[model samples]
Target chain A: MKEEIIISGFGGQGVLSMGKILAYSALLENKEVSWMPAYGPEQRGGTANVTVIISDELISSPILNSFDTAIILNQQSMDKFEPKIKPGGVLLYDPHGITRAPVRKDIRIHTVDATEIASDMDNSKAFNMIVLGAYLKVLPIVQLKSILEGLRKTLPARHHKLIPMNEQALQAGMDRVK
Target chain B: MKGIHLMKGNEAIAHAAIRCGCDGYFGYPITPQSEILETLMEEKPWESTGMVCLQAESEVAAINMVFGGASCGKKVMTSSSSPGVSLKQEGVSYLCGADLPCLIVNIMRGGPGLGTIQPSQSDYFQSTKGGGHGDYHLIVLAPNSVQEMADFVGLGFDLSFKYRIPALILSDGVIGQMMEKLRLPAFKPRATEEEIARDCPWALSGRTGMRPQNIISSLELDPAIMEKRNLERHERYRKVEATEVRYDTFMCDDAEFLIVAFGCAARICQKSVELLREQGIKAGLLRPITLWPFPKKAIEGYCRQVRSILTVELNSGQMVEDVRLAVDGKVPVGHYGRMGGIVPTPEEIVEALKKNS
Candidate 1:
């Protein structure tokens, strides 16, 4: 199966890194993947997005006009990317920064209060992981074991101690996705 | 050593240069390509491989430094984006005139001037038709994937040294910034001084008692001698064109229409080819990996079978001219592109093909 996904949020919300982790997980599964970001000045406190494509065949263009899934973290991203998701596709977002709900009826839209949960866990950095966990819960495109391996590969060894905490955040998100 | 790793195209080039036993790199920071210099700086190859990585004051300075290093027969290189490459033109010309071998990478962005720092192939004319002054040709290689981005560095150096001409990797912002999995080549040590002396006896290393002193100069005041030198360079270019032409054809066995593109545009065209095939349209892609060599023979072979051709690029229209020349009016040749940092989608390319065909 091929999954063309876009993850968008504020520059500091780890939107790009989350896409990198997803792409890396696909790599761990021996799949063909490409990760492209809305880079340059747009990456400085502005609405940033990354396109990640995981496929069994060769990926052609890293740039795309539509996506199979969009993981949006803020209202700005929701407004920009909601309509871009393909019909019957998936749209997952955090309600914390969303002012207006996704109005699309054709695609699946799910919400998780990732910010509040991350705050409750007392780690602001876990916000992205929680959202990622919710994405996994909703779609299950990749295996959880592969994601853990992806996390190990993407994170530096100096931060290995935080893996358990990250796992807790992921589990919390998976639990709260309903 | 034989493993896959996720790496950006810029980082892949840097790593490949180190692995290919490049002796030195001189470059200035530019958007979409800064990662190349940054990665090299972080690696600090000087500490391990004794490879010199210097950040020059400007792109002009960087290319001139490349000239000096390459004149000594070292595997030296420099990289920049569109505007920065424009600044290095004079140095590039001088290197060509002196017949020095070096690798120059243009990870291009949008341009006519200092345009957006987004992916663009607008520098096709500058790269293939000669951005520098004078009548000289660079061995230009366009890489579509991150793996090709890494592979081309070694191949570029090999071709450059083989012809004693400057070689250019004509990539754009998209291919330079995007990330993919790649298996890097095994590490090769830089050439020893004795090896350099043996390979390049004309290099200004030092004069042995048996041979005459060597001088590296591009200045030729005498027009007659200059014409002779130009003819000699053209002869070398002719030989390169005969032997170094490289291209990739996708699904062209029974294709009725052909799509011509290079670098990043070629990758998008591949998808368009697939889409067209799905729609029962017999379309194929001719990807020119070696742009300077132009892949004229391969393209000409397709001209007889394909009813028409569409050339797509990220620029207004540059390589399209080359396509027309190659086809030589055997079939209709049309052009489609998106400039000013906007990349055309695969659907858009298919639409253009349908319209043109």
Candidate 2:
């Protein structure tokens, strides 16, 4: 199965990192993957995002017109990418930030209080991990173990201790849908 | 030969340079291309493997440093993007004029100004023909994927040494930004310094013993000597065109429509081929891995088998002129592209094919 996901928010909101984690997870799963950011000036405050593609075969291009999954961490992200969700795709939105509703009903829209959840867990940045968890629950493209392994490989040595907390956040988010 | 190790193109290129036994790297930080410097900085191959990495004060200094390093008969490399590469052109011209061996990589971003930091193939003519000036050619290698991105550094260096000419790895935003698994290759050291000195008597290393000191300059003031030098460079170019043109042909043997593209543009063209195939249109991608030497022979051969050739690029059809020249009126050569950081989607390319053909 070929799945394309876009993670978008403000520049410092860990939007790019969220996309990277999924892309890395897919890579660890041995699936063909690609991660491309909206580079240059567009990344300033104007809805920065990354496109990640996971496929059973070689990925041709990183650019995508529509996404199988859209993870919006803010209102601007929701406003920008809401129109481009693929038919019957999924949108995992942070309810605290995204104060909008879906325009179309065909796509599955899961609204999570990710910001509140992260705050309750004593880390606001962990919101990205919560979104990734929701993505994992919905797609299950890679094993949870693979996602953990990806985090181990990708997280910096200084932030190595944050792995377990982020993993806990992921598990908490995954438990939401169940 | 298992190819898979989740790497960015910048990291891949660094590792590839290490595998090619590249003796030195000189560069400064530039967006998109900065990670290349970052990777090599962290890898610290110099202390362990005798490889040298230095961040020069400026792009100009970096490229000139490359000239100084290459002059010592070592496999040296430097990288930059649009603005930074513009600064390095003087050194590039000098390197080419003096017939020095080195590798230069341009992870092209939007340009003509600080156009944007996003990916772009707009540097096509500059890289392929001459970014600097004066009847010089760079052996340009374009890698569309991260795997090829890593592997081409070694290939670029090898070709540079073999021809004593500068070779460029022409990548763009997509190649630089994307991540893919890459199987690191075993490192192999090439010829020794003594062997290179023996091969290149023209190298400017303060000639000693029974030999006159040779000045490595392209300035030939004498008409007769100038003509001879030009003839020699022309001969080398001809040999490169005849023997060194590298390209990949996909379903083009009996293809009815041929799509010619390179670098990141060609990867998109692959999707165009697939889309056209689904639409009952037989189209194939003719990806020129080597932009210079023009891949004329391969393009012309493919032009013969297909009814028409569509040249696609990220620029305003800069490579189309070369395609036209290579096809030489044998077939209809057309152009399709999006410039100024606009990437032409598969549907758009297929539409262009439909309209043009």
DockQ scores for all the models shown? 0.65, 0.54
* All candidates: TM-score: 0.98, 0.94
Q: For model 2, how does the per-residue alpha-carbon lDDT over B2-58 read when each residue is reduced to its tens digit? A: 456777888899988877888899999888888899999999998767889999999
Query: After aligning candidate 1 to the native by TM-score, how far in Å is the CA of A133 from where it should be?
Result: 0.6
Off by over 4 Å in 2: A41-46, B1-3, B190-192, B205-212
User: Clashing residue pairs, candidate 2?
Assistant: B5-B181, B5-B182, B6-B181, B119-B173
Tens-digit per-residue lDDT, A1-178, candidate 1: 8999999999998889889988998899999999999888864478888999999988988888889999998888898999999999999999987889889999998888999999999999999889989999998888888888888988999998888988898888899985
The C-alpha stretches of model 1 lying farther than 4 A from their native spots are none
Cα RMSD, each candidate? 1.2, 2.2
lDDT of 2 at B130: 94
